[model samples]
Structure formats: structure tokens, C-alpha cells
Target: MTANERDNIRAAMDRLLAGIPLRSNGALTIVRLAEEADVKRHVLTHRHTDLKDEFYARIRAQGHVPDSGRRLRERLEQAEARLEALREENAELRAVNEGYARVVNLLTLENTELDKGDGARVVPLRRP
Candidate 1:
């Protein structure tokens, strides 16, 4: 390829990567992008050294690198944050449940102690 053609191809690749969504539906793969850019699958994989480097450099200049690893890291951070929030919620619920259980136990003990008192007992009579 001529110098200009190589530059154009690199530009196309940069544009394609930039357009990819941050959250994908499924596994992150580059076949669709390669097809869209009219580049072969092997070019995106086995023969992508020059274009991949240029693409990463350009995206990094924009303060981010575009790739599966970066996306996975971002997702992992989000998941960890969600897990932390859930753990806090669970702790709060457990504390509330413990308080309720203690109240129930105390009430039961009081009822049992009252039953032992021998004050005037009024038992209900059943008619046969």
C-alpha cells in the first residue's frame, strides 16, 4: 500500500474503534468493526500491528484506550461498587432483624415468668 493509503486505512480504523459502544451486548469482538471498515479479519488480528498501535495512540491521546481489557476493567469497577452497596444494605437489614428477634425473645420470657404467678386465677369453664 502507498503511504497515503496506509494513512487512510489507519484513519478508518481509528474512526471505527472510536465509534464502538462502551457497553456491548455480549462478548467483545472486533470482527464486526473489521467488516464495517472493509478490512479483513486477519488484518484486525494477525496483521494489525501498525494499525493497532496507531489506533491505541490516538485514542490514548484522547485520554482513553479502547480495547476489551479496558472495557472489562470499567465493568469490574462498576460491579464492585454495586457489590459494596448491596453489602451495606444487607448489614442494615441484618441489624434490624436481630433487633426484632431480641424483642420477641424478651416478650416470650416475660410471658413465661407471668404464668408462674399464683395470683387469683380465672380459668374458663367449658359446658359439656
Candidate 2:
């Protein structure tokens, strides 16, 4: 009714946006919205008709502005596919790295032996 009271209702609406769940757990209801906003339900219904309409519109909209559920689902699927590809690439790289390690080890041993045979200084190999 009063300007300060209306401001309180608006503030409550902002808080409700964060507390209300999207779709999985539980949808935002007027009752839950009032609870989060710390205001009585009547404040939304009688005192501020515009706020009440906005609240219901948001619930109906289900945050359709940015990415809707369908789009989010597609993106999630794409991400999962990309993750699988990365995992496979990681496995392949590990195998290649292991092969390189074995070759490096063998070559280092061969070099050490040659150095000893020719009286050349044997340099210890440091791992990179």
C-alpha cells in the first residue's frame, strides 16, 4: 500500500528469483515466492497488483528469455559428446607418450653404454 511497503515487496521478488528452483526440484509458486520475499501473500495480491502479475508471468515463462529447456538440453548433449571425445583423445595421447618414453629410455641406455666404451664422459640424463 505504502511506497516503502511496495519497495519491500519488490525486494522480496528479487530474493524469490534466487530461492525458487527452475524445473527439476520444484517450480516457483506464488506461495513460495512470498516466503522468499519475506512478504505476506496479500502484499502481492492486493497491495501491488503489478508485482503479482509479474510474478505469475515469470513462473509461466520459466526463464525463457536466454536459453530455454530445449536449448539447454541440446547444449548439454553437445558438451557430453565433446567430453567423450576429449577423453578418447587423452587416452590416445597417453599411449603415444608411453611409446615415446620407452624409446627415450632405450636410447639413453644405448648412449650411456657407448660413452663408457669410448671413454667419453657419461652425462646423466635429466627428466624433462
Index of the highest-TM-score prediction = 1
After superposition, the stretches of candidate 2 with alpha carbons farther than 4 Å from their true spots are 1-67, 118-128
Flag regions of model 1 displaced more than 4 Å.
1-8, 14-33, 65-88, 119-128
TM-score of each: 0.52, 0.43
How do the residues 15-105 of candidate 2 rate in per-residue lDDT, one tens digit apiece?
5555554322233555665665566778777877888898767755766432355678999999999999999999999999999999999
33-96 per-residue lDDT for model 1 (tens digits) = 4554456667766666676566556656766544677879999999999999999999999999
Q: Estimate candidate 2's alpha-carbon lDDT, on a 0 to 1 scale.
A: 0.70
Cα displacement (angstroms), candidate 1, residue 35, comes to 4.0
Every candidate's lDDT: 0.64, 0.70
TM-score of structure candidate 2? 0.43
